[model samples]
Target chain A: MQLLNNRSAQLRAPGKRVSRARVAVVRAAKTADGPRVAIVGVTGAVGQEFLTVLKERNFPYSDLKLLASARSAGQKQEFEGHTYTVQELTENSFKDVDIALFSAGGSISKKFGPVAVKDGAIVVDNSSAYRMTEGVPLVIPEVNPEAMSHIKVGKGGAIIANPNCSTIIALMAVTPLHRLATVKRMCVSTYQAASGAGAAAMEELRQQTRDVLDGKPAQPKIFPLQYAFNLFSHNSGMDVELGYNEEEMKLVKETRKIWSFPSVRITATCVRVPVMRAHAESINLEFENDISEAAALEALAAFPGVSIINDRQNNRFPTPLDATTKDNVFVGRVRRDISRDDNKGLDLFVCGDQIKKGAALNAVQIAELLLK
Target chain B: MQLLNNRSAQLRAPGKRVSRARVAVVRAAKTADGPRVAIVGVTGAVGQEFLTVLKERNFPYSDLKLLASARSAGQKQEFEGHTYTVQELTENSFKDVDIALFSAGGSISKKFGPVAVKDGAIVVDNSSAYRMTEGVPLVIPEVNPEAMSHIKVGKGGAIIANPNCSTIIALMAVTPLHRLATVKRMCVSTYQAASGAGAAAMEELRQQTRDVLDGKPAQPKIFPLQYAFNLFSHNSGMDVELGYNEEEMKLVKETRKIWSFPSVRITATCVRVPVMRAHAESINLEFENDISEAAALEALAAFPGVSIINDRQNNRFPTPLDATTKDNVFVGRVRRDISRDDNKGLDLFVCGDQIKKGAALNAVQIAELLLK
Candidate 1:
């Protein structure tokens, strides 16, 4: 361990590396009006993050139920001041729950998410199961909280879908500028982190880096390519006819759906980098109207969960390390696209913790929106 | 060393991990008309590659002179069983030299290149010093060899400039498709390597990684940001008015000059990655004529110094490790841009050894063209 760069700065962006938020312990002093909350798929990466986020945000709940697959059932999970045994998720799990957070795979979400919603529980699903469905609202709380504002817990059964992690991160920075001057076209190149692939992929990267440092060949168990000191196109299945992968399509289609615009031009090249949790994107946008650097910067600065690290004189910009374990998407390299003669094109480099803001935190924020 | 991923899989792209080519040892049995070569900045990264490229190409030389700064004047360098003393580069260094290959800094090249040309030696400069100059030809041998065909050894002296690494790597992959269908606009996002910043940055990355792994701070010496598992925008000075860096401007300007198509729109976001020596670029191009994936792949495959690694089924594509110390530019992700309504847009991922094809190998190829 002493001979290597083994430390990972996940969710702990540099310049703000110190973690100040500790998990808050909430006792079982609940009122009759408080909601009953259930965390589905509680053993997985994003699943575990739901608990941490709920604790850190001091989310109030009258009853807490932890559910997972059969393999993880009977496992003990310590959250706040309570020790709870993980129960295997079944049709009856959401019997009296007012809100359920789903992060299991698509099939699991497809099976259990609808069941949870039918049981009078508002399901905030972090899977692609409900997203892109005609009626399901794909929400990024800061970007489109109004899209799901009509649904309230204990009133009706509903499903609020979490946008893909990449989409969540990109839109957090782009939405503000889009409001200033409607985005006509968007060209995005993503430097995604291992966390997007799940906990196994993150472990695979860490172990591979260890193996490669020990002069061993990186075993490609989780991914098909070497993930140590190398980057490659996204591991998503490519749509042969369109030449776009499923991941790229998510960014393109999801953006249009979330913004409620059908004809917005979007293109993306998504590549997986060796970083642990934070994802960085190089986004170029062409707007319908002229937008200057000062205007664009101002819009990004005012956006919630967005930070400006653009120090051009010092050449300091956002890196994955700067967004590790961070809530805000770090925006920098904010500039005009010199290729376009019209003052309509702008470029930005964005970094955010895909596991946090892109997943659990965003889902929790959506759940918070239900209270309002 | 044992605790880190110190092993570099340079030639280990797919199945080819073993390096087969040994450095050729050449004796001075050349004919009378052969060129006398002087390698300026012989102690630097590209300077070292110039020697390797010359040896691998079996370039004919009657005599070889190794020239560096005053500090390295007396160091011994062996070539093809001939041990030579490094000489300090002065105004008189090119007195009898017929050809000079310069990998020195821009100032050194700007100062000595004109001197060498004045002393009857054609200088093939591998610096940004003369690339954008009005009359100087910025040539990528495979892309625009004819740009400097008029200059040759033993004739009147002239300066031939090597295009920027990002430009060279991109053009190698783009020029072929551009020939098939004229490119009207190009958008490039580069994942550049440490070598383009010269050898010290490479060493800094190595030392920094070791220091960081040893639980010590990554002291940013050559770069402002942490180089171990972190990336940033190109460290080149920014153009405040244009909001583009010197490197991004090089790609935008050099592409136009090399292609001699001034109206073509080009924009580049140059980023520095942690990769050791090779560069990877994600390029999206819009063309005047429709080009299919078959046609684009065919064009890339037919190009002399370009290779296609686009394996959709296996999810295999060109990676930086595949291009390390390689002569060919590895291209992949040959697909139509899904966002385009017409067949006007295409996307590609390209990787090339910046020190080799981007600099030394390219400069040496110019020398070969001069011989022809």
Candidate 2:
């Protein structure tokens, strides 16, 4: 274990360090002709969600290992109706695993992910840890599957990153249209669900709701403030220069990266809503060229993994309730953004289950690519 | 009644004719010199809210008349322990009333309001009726107190229109700042409460919430769609030019008009939330010159009727729960609008009880001016 930690430290340097132990592990897994899987921080919110996705999607796996902090070790969880005991993640946790899913905090992923990869397991990290790493692929399977090709096999396994939850929900609606028309700028306001904050936050929302309903004082624990029937700016501390929070900046950076549009400008206001599951976004886009409402609708309708729910005549549109528990991103309230130049702009309302398409589902889709 | 309707038709345009025969009867109780007041639509949501505001503010009045639709007529309501029976509105009902508070639907106001005014009573209308009329003052007491001067005296009674619920809440936060710096443009998305749709709509939200909790089917009647744990675009029909629904467009127009900034460009997305009381708005504004966040916060803090709840360090920002049943508009999450130039931009999260400041409170405040 100490030897593995030493090798991981070497890999953490800016320039890559070749690790013989990682290469050996990958070679052994490859020779066995069966995929080995490990889940890092398997007791966290996204970690638990990833487990559900793997079982529901029926990911091809011969061996599955659940790893978490020493504090959560020895806990039993049921995946695919099979109880699996969590093991304390150590330097050698990924010795025989072929694919590792990391949903722990960024700091943990930053310190341990490279070590796991060096020990031969491909990492699909659901954190900001290596998302901006120059050589790493930040993959949203529906939008950028090609990025997955960069994953290395035996020589220090490749690391794939997932975009932030809010970014994924917003881009899911616009990426298809951007492919049709060059999206120049976008203004978005996100109504994010409590679950996006993690499991404890969701529990806080439920408790606060119960408290408020029962005429008891709401004592918020997980969130910085009460989450009962309230909305607030994303929890990022104030930014002096742009007034954009850390979450908003993540949306801007991740969307640009995922869409491969470096020059496209994005501004976002991420809000925490009282909702428990899905996230809703109100987006206004300015395109380079004219895109008629009909044309935009048709383009969106044809996009994979995107569903158009606009029916102004019947007063129907995509809402969190409609998108909850669904894998597909729902887009609606599509109209030409009359506030912008004629025919060159559009306004849309989008909703998607943050835990699904925004997190676990996207991770599962990436794992599916491994089979192909 | 036919004669009264005919007379009202001659004074107004064809489409602006007030309905006939409906009047609010006021039983005068002698007092030294105070005016006699009557509240129409007294049994509905806004009307019930008006009762609270009137009693809390203690607006001087010698007599109070409570009027409702014929279906609710004769129902007894107590205010400060004085029981008042709701009387059906008729053409001659306003004979001795000095001020009438009108909060019925637009059609009801359009039909009967003129008769109230014709019968020598000043009406502070909570409906959209006569809002755009040339001589009518659309008042928000805080924004345009001088507009109340246009209220007629005795014979030809003046009608003061209250702005839309969403508009009043948004403007309450922006109006004070717009006074200091020139507001060039604004983008707003409203999370409006079900009470804004009236009594039945609020009941529907409660029922839907119950149904959702019990795993029963949610049948939406007041709204065109389900209101349980969901949000939707303002259900007003799509216009021919692909502009926003009437509700969305009304926020834009009313804000500009109330601020007396007709040229200020504004875009709005009005969404209906399952919330029962307060309406929350995510507002982004672009100013004419550089407006530092410090300066914006200072301006808002000093502004009357606008409370600053922006303690980001403690996450003590405003929410619907914080603003519910409160008169002041709760403004927080104050930051710079990163999408625009820093010096000339600000983003704000504001919440206010839509039934109160948005409708009933504003109307009562205007009526207070009539008393003076």
Candidate 3:
């Protein structure tokens, strides 16, 4: 795990230049008898977290290939007691890799993901790319582990997409209850963490906090304005009509795909907060069938990978602080949505570490599925 | 002026017990020419804000009386350059007073407010006590100025109630749009500041922030848990039927009352943020008729007390950092709510200094109606 521990290693190349000799050397070093893993855009935030997850989970890997853009070539990353050199991601980067974990931007995935699949590597993409594709499976291991079995790797390696971070956190709580009662409509507002924006944005929030506390002028380079002590609409570009940002749209679409409910009307307001990790969602759900708050709580408590933190009497429930650095999604503040008809609606507050359940952990879990 | 500066003076007595000689002293203090103002429960958070509002607005007063529970009696508070000792609040506290401002807990207002009215003082209550009362006018000056005209003196002096902080901030922006186009439904998620809870809660947040940043043990006092760098559902208690908490219910009820829309459906999720002053709301609204995003922006720009800050191209919008210390509510990220029917739905992000427009400023505005 030397690579995961070495935080100062330069993860990106100073310029865009690919070395054919390096790619050849790295390809020759890989072993076919052992687990072969390819990390696409390994310099990004989720990509870095993926490295940690693989190490922490003790994934059986004999050889790992670090892949990024041409500009990231020659950068070094260490994992599992071995230091791996980064290779410029090309059309054939996944030629002999057993598993390819993609967290590069959606556009990059859109352009290079299929090429990796054609190279006979199972692709677990952590971007919006291929998520809504008709045949592609968007999976949350806890919610849809069975979907991973449908992966076809003979003709073309299968691409498994991860759900949106906000959607994954919300659905981890809502899905269990939906099984007890069909969720008809849901309203969710996300208090998303800064890390969701990637490494540079996280650094910006950290620097801003330091500047504001020290009475120095704080310049927001990644965000539009000050985010040190404020909340704002999700930063994704605004949609033409519904005024929802691309982030909010991702939640709406991803939840439907994961839950297999294309007609379920989900309205979301995704807000970016100053918190460093974990995202919280305030949710109100309407069900087709009547359900009591107690019953909903029972269902949530029984669900896997979901913890019931709703103890209002003791003033205990989920908060972003409680969810950070943990893998489980926390659900609390269970009550009936009084504004709805009778007991047909329920209100819940949910929080989860976005870097874990929302990204790296899910991707790593999908890789484990390939081994099984 | 002495009273204004020494706003936290202790009340005079500890219980409801008042000597006849003390009553005589109170009677003799009333002047013939000066307007009489009664401060109900002059010991709480909103009660303190009312004192500042009076001083800042320089409300003309010949005499002032501070009234609170017997437990808080003998406490002194200064207003407008005069130090006034707290008197035991009773059914007779409003005798001969021209106007009374109530911010005590609801139970106290329910018991003493009607009695104050019977004694011939118009009451502007800051509690939930009279808000939903049949004849009680729930007022936000910018949204419903005419509601003040309904407050008449000596006809069992009518009681006017201030809307909830979240409701007031939302309506300040929504009222302008509703007037231009009929609003059918609203989905609001609030990121409320800790100050909305009161002075002690604000202090708790500050301490928690220091503790977290300094690597000290953080403790939760005013809140159920640590308040630094985290978010939680605003209401901790659950409802019997609809899992909505009392705070969420207030947003729904108060919005309908302020907008005078009995049939409009509103779903709200209120969460407490670590921020100190301004409260931010992510709103999704549907109109009866199709409305273009451009038209809505034009209407919002021309609307009074509303400022548009949406500049997605530059990543600028309303945030608590920008809203704090400001009087008017700031609205931005205005666009159509694409999650709903095309142009029929709109999404908006709004922020306002909760302690100002949400409380003190609105109270002062209501007091201005008294002069008119």
Candidate 4:
């Protein structure tokens, strides 16, 4: 635990060498009965979190391999009490690997995902490269584990895609209510964090904030605008014709694909806030049938991986920090939409750790489903 | 201009004494024909901004009076090349004042606003004290200036209330579209700034941020949660039964009142971000009649005190920083909501200076309206 704290501190100081003193010495017991797991892009933010989640969840594995881009290939990573050098990702990197977790950017996943699948590894991809692909099963374990039930470890080569972080976080809170009454439409506005952009962006936020406090002008490098004390529309590619940025479109398209309800109308506005890792979303839902706030709270309480913070008396609801480093998505402000006369509409505020439930943990849960 | 920048810098440093060097030298060339102006709660954020906005717009005033709570009384405030002591607000303060701008808390406004009006001074309130009061106009200058046309300078006393900051920012962008097509339903998610809470809260945010960056615990005094690198639901009183905060309900009720269309459905989720002064909103509108994106843009472009920043090719949209200290509200992301098949739904991102258009400047505009 102390070593983990030291390592976390070191992460904030970019360009610093990983000293031996900060290495986590806690080791997982290897079992021959378990599968051989390989983690692609082990040097990135979500990649490092994959290791933490796997260890915390005690995901059983007989052997583990870490792979990254050539630039990070020679770097040493300490995981499960073992120091392993990250290898350059290539077609041969997945040889004899039973389960592979991929979280590199889209292009890297696009180039290497098929190679791993063909090599008999079940690829659990955490990129946009395969999420919208027709044959790929975009899975959010709590919402739809059945989407990828056909793929299993040691069964055959296959690919299961993880939905976007924002989509995964939103559905975690909404899907439970959605189950009670079919959703006719959804409108989501996101207060996203720096982590969604990656480790470097988070560092930039910290450094820029420091500079600004010191009375120096904030230098923007990762984002086009000053991010120290400001928020802006998501820095995603724009769909000029549609007038929706790529991040907003992802929420629209991915929700339908995940819900398997193609006709469910959805719109989203994605903005990046100055928070560190967690993401908060304000969601408005119109249901096809009457779904009272009481019924929605009951459904959310029963749903696994969901927690309620709706204490209206105290005005204490979920903030980004409430969900930081937490597994379950935190939901609050559950109320019937007063705008509509019928009780078919609801409003919710949800927060979840962008790196945990939004990315690494959700992907790990998918891997767990594969075992079942 | 240099003096204004110096004052701005000094304002960020709370508990510090105001140096004479920061006082403005540019006088407003007061005319005897102009109205007598009194600013209530002159030590607060919006009250201080009232001075700046009045000077920038060159609103003619024969004489100026600064009033605040007893705690701030006797403090010297320099404006228009002269230093005057802030006086304690009292019944006698509005003896000869033609326009009294009230921005104190609701209690202060409730107590003194009537006193000012009864003293024959026209009160332009920047609190919820009289917003929903019968016959008291809830005015957003760009949206409903004529709501208070019955009252004029040197006429019998009347009170006009400024809508809440969030409502002011949202309606500025939505009213233009609503004019083109009557709005049936509206959903708003606000990214509010610290200024909405007042000057002390803004100071708390800055202090908390400095402490957080220095590795010390963020001691949240003005807010219940950490304000640095974090966002939270608005800290206003919540309605336990309705499950809406006072801030959110204000948006819903004030919009209906300002539009004079009591049946117009509106719901809002208000969250305070770490921004300094500007507020941003993601607004989704459902109109009674079809309104195309082009027509909506045309209406917005022709509207007064509105600016368009919809640069899709660059993914540029209205950001809080972009509207900071600006007189006009910035609107962007003008697109038809693909969620609805018809052209009746539209999504917009809007930002406005919470102190300027949302509070002080809007109140000033109301004072200007009385002249005509």
Candidate 5:
């Protein structure tokens, strides 16, 4: 697999299309036939990216079905050089479907996930509906593909949960190190982007920015507070007693489920920044065993789907724009934590496209694993 | 002092001038006499802010002199309803000056600081030049006024250093809690603003953002990387050997000096965000003694130059816009650290104006202490 860190500059170019052959690692061919695929929430930010990622990875699908709510039904979407009208999603929509990608929302996933699974589709859910379910395999394909190894295409119906965006992005960089030195505690502070809410949130940011620049008052519609040239705490519901927002708790709870390490302590502070697409995180990790900076960087460089940009001489580290629309999670500022007296702590800064690796691509990767 | 958290909404209002009488805590008036004051780097961001803050706080000045580099020497600046020409900063610029506020840069402070002191001018240097210098008191008036008790107007000449902006903002919230429970370890991640770099960087952000909105490429000038809708690690010089930038190290080293406790373990990841003028930080602390959320909030509320906006019910915490051009450091998301099972850990989000409290207001407050 090619180390895609050098392509980071090209990825930031506006309207530039990336070639999948150069970006995605070629998977071993299993059967000569591809599965029938269905994408739930075909009009959402993550749902739209699912098509792009599938087309980019050259995922073979015998029949592609675009599913959305009634409001978005009949919408025309172009995918793989073909235009398809989105169909209203229902229980009977998953007939003979081999793979189903769900990203509408947690409520929709909760109502329709089992319905689609009962119809014999291997449902790869992007929502939080089944993520913490005991039997559901919450997976980041690069980190833990074996969790869902029992399920395969054309087999009995199964639901594989994709971890939350913050969890996926953080684990993309931390899991490699966790394997080297057991992670004892993790502290993550996220600079999240506008796209995590939905496509409308991204549009709202663009429109609000224009209004603020023109000296017009920013109308807060999608968000409760002004978001133009400004940022706020994540709008997720908060556990008022615990003082932790749902977004922060998601990182804590989701990581424990994905890593299957319930004993590892984790805390996070998630805030929404005005950036368009990608999310950035400042992660501090404490390890059970001593790990040096050189050894950590060596392991990160060798990890698949991980790109490093630790250029201290130039002071160039990962930025959100560097990871916008990119496949790999960009990691930098890899250093031993000076706060710790021993080499048991490390600090890192990571950036990844929240809509891609955080949601769509991770779900698609799980779908790829099922094909095996 | 009246709690100003209620005025946070008005603070975010565009083009609204904050009335100082409603903002600043009333200090005791010494003598009828006022000091002869000079502002070094009067044309820069913090330099301009020093003029506003001085006027707002009603700092008594017998005569106000503006000093900058030769290029900005002839520029006229209006203050307190009078216009003054900026003079070229030199050894003779401080003649008969009782108080000199310096914000030009490190090199300018290094050279003119001693000159001003030799001329019997109390120099409040707002640079990193002498922050860690032994015997040179680094003060945040509310946090450590006693550090400069020996220096006074008309008594003798001395140079007092102001801590870094990130350090000042973080400590404004943390110091109060530290007083309650001794901090054994502190981890800070900053969402800094462009104003910290200087006025030019702020202008660059404005211009670049406009260009990007117009679909043109962002032309990076003040910063090497794209600054519009993007963030990067602090552009301060890096210590390649230690893998820490000079900005991050300043927080670690300056905190120990200000608190007069060198044993506290501190680590920081400083990143510049797209915000215009204010900085926000996510701070996690481990204390030697146990502290609760209610106890932490009580200490913070009682602390001067700090305001609490921890409304967990509304998920309305402090944003950078809430602290822009405000005197008080706005704090929110005050909660017990769920990462630790014990009550010894706490988490806080802090925001402060980089040019005001982080730079000018802090320097003026130190000058206020000197007035006594």
Candidate 6:
């Protein structure tokens, strides 16, 4: 499988259409009827990342359908050397598809997710639509694959929800430690990238930064605040009564659901930074039982899709650029909290591409588990 | 006093130098015999900010001395219609000085701060050199002017230390609430700006961002990592045994000294963001006594040099740019922490200019108290 990690890979011209021999590989698998794949919201950022992740993972697929809003219909997109015209997403779009990857916003997912499931196409939803819906499974494959084990691509269709990007990125690093220490409370402060707000926000950052650098005023269209070299609270709607924004609450709520620990206490401050791709979080955790730093490091090192970059002597912990376009969630600055006398408190920093593992790749991994 | 808020104020090309008639304001009465002033490390970011702040606040000075390292010694600086040649700093430089504003790095401050005091100059040091030193008062003028009341201009010389930037900014908003509710524990995560590192680091952020936008590799010179479109753990030397960096520990240690509360439990994680001149911090406080959100807001609004910008309905909160050259520390996202059911935990976000309110303006305010 070819791993695509940057703009160069995304913009690389197709090296001729896939040869007949390459297509034959799909014929050897039981699920290789490639569960006719359909990507809802194919014109969006995570929509684009879904295709990249699918191609990179070499997921067996036969026919592919690109679906988006009516406005984006008929747009030409090249995937794996084949040019496909986007079809406007509708109730009937998933009729014969065996698997569907939905990256449209929550309303679109809430409306179409069930429609797609009714058509027998297992849905791996990237939005938060059915995530907390009773009996609907929210899965981060590396963290909780068993959550959706009953749903198989060929046998039946069901909507498997993806956790929030920050939640997914954070749990990827902290869950391993949790398994060992039994985390009692968690506090997180996020340095989120502009991409988490979508492609337009990312472009706004680029344009605004360009203007700021050229000694011009920053005209913030996507965000109401200056975003070129400044940051603010997450733009999500605030729960005025609770004083927590939707993003912060998502981190708190989603972690509990994904970990199946309803009693866990969590607090988060989500702020939008001007970084282009990955998100970085500073997390401090209190455990029910004392866990040494070495034990936590050992656990994190063994966790799948979790990479450790804790270099203390050189002071090189994870940075967003190090995790940009990368698959693994990079964890660093791992150490015990000095404020706690008990060995139960620990702190760490995490960075992961919000588009990849946080959104697209996690949903794609869920699709893979459906095949298994 | 006129307050300058942006580059138009800082970068305004010098008009014709002021006439001799305009210079007589320094000859006015009171503290206007305006103790002769010496600005140490005048070529650096905070040092230059000291000059602007003094000019903006109408800080009275009879004669101004600009001092820097030998490399910057010959530079010409125009201040209040007078052009003064930068003088290479030496022990003898403070002989005629009544008040010295020091923003040179710690080593220089340690080496020269005492010398300036011995030479009968009251030194308002902006480095971390003597902040925690015994009998050397660490002050935030609004919060702890009493700590420096003993030192008066023209009476005797003394070294008064300015607290660390992050510590000063955090305490500006939190201390007011602490007075009302008695904070028991504080957990802070800072999004520090490039200017905290100095003028060269700010230039690096600009240059590297341009390079990254042009598809060129970010050439990291001032910072070891690519700071453009990214964030990293604070670069201060890490205490390997405690796993806390110098920046984080300074927040813990300095809070104790400035608040004069020895037993308060505090922890901090400091990360450097891409913003140019201001630092933003997300702070969570657990109080010993319950404090209502309205009460906290009331306290903050009534505090000097603390402004509230939390408009929950408009989703408008403080950003780094909003506080860039502003004297006030902007506080927002003020609310009770939902994760804590006890009404004792409150969360807020703060932004203050790293060079202005955090360092230079703070030092100048301390100097003002010295005059009183």
**lDDT (Cα, tens digit) per residue for candidate 6, span B39-148:** 99999999889988887777876667889998998898866554567889987888888999999999999999989988889999999999999999999989988888
- Clash pairs, candidate 4, are none
Query: What's each prediction's clash count?
Result: 13, 10, 43, 0, 0, 0
TM-score of each: 0.91, 0.88, 0.81, 0.93, 0.92, 0.94
Native interface contact recovery, model 3: 0.48
Sequence-dependent TM-score of model 1: 0.91
Q: Please identify which of the two predictions, 1 or 5, would achieve the higher DockQ against the true structure.
A: 5
Best model number under TM-score? 6
Give lDDT for model 5: 0.88
* Model 3 lDDT per residue over A1-372, tens place: 333223223223355343665444333433345467889989988889888887667676655778898899998775533467788889877767768899998998898888877778888999988899988889988888887786744445778998888988999999988889899888777899998999898888867766776778889898877877777777888764445678888888888888888888877878898887899998878898989878988898888889889766555679898988787999987877655557788878899999888899988888887777
Tens-place lDDT digits, model 6, residues A1-372: 111122124434567445675454323321335667889998999999998888778877766788999999989887664467788998888877888999999999989988988888898898888888878899999888998888887776788899999999999999999999898888899999998989999999999999999999999898988899999999999877777898998898888888999989898999999999899999989899999989999999999999999988889899999999999999998988877778899989999999999899999889888877
By DockQ, the candidates rank as: 4, 6, 5, 1, 3, 2
For candidate 6, the per-residue lDDT at B258 reads 90
In candidate 5, how many Å is residue A331 off?
0.7
TM-score of the second chain in each model?
Answer: 0.92, 0.89, 0.86, 0.92, 0.91, 0.93
User: Per-residue CA lDDT of candidate 1, range A188-280, in tens?
Assistant: 998888999999998898778767777899899989888887888999988766768889999999999999998999999999987788898
How much is the lDDT of residue A24 in candidate 1?
Answer: 18
Candidate 1 falls in which docking quality class? Answer: medium
Native interface contact recovery, all models? 0.55, 0.42, 0.48, 0.89, 0.86, 0.77
lDDT of 2 at A340: 58
Question: What is every candidate's C-alpha DockQ against the true complex, given to 2 decimals?
Answer: 0.50, 0.34, 0.35, 0.75, 0.72, 0.73
lDDT of 3 by residue, B211-266 (tens): 77777888988787777778887744556445566787788888888777887778
- Taking all chains together, the TM-score of candidate 3 against the true structure is 0.81
Given candidate 5, what's the lDDT at residue A143? 92
Candidate 5 structure quality by residue, lDDT tens digits, A1-372: 011222233445677665674434222111237787889998999999998898778887666788999999988886543357788998888986889999999999899989988888899999988988999999999998989989977778889999989999999999999999999999999999999999999989988988988999999999999998888999999999999998898899988888888988998999999899999999999999999999999999999999999999999999999999999999999999999899999999999999999999999999888877
lDDT of each: 0.86, 0.78, 0.78, 0.89, 0.88, 0.87
Alpha-carbon DockQ of candidate 3: 0.35
Model 5 alpha-carbon drift over 4 Å, by segment: A1-32, B1-32
User: In model 6 chain A, which range of ten residues has the least summed lDDT?
Assistant: A1-10
Candidate 4, superposed: residue stretches over 4 Å from native: A1-29, B1-28
**What lDDT score goes with residue A154 in model 6?**
73
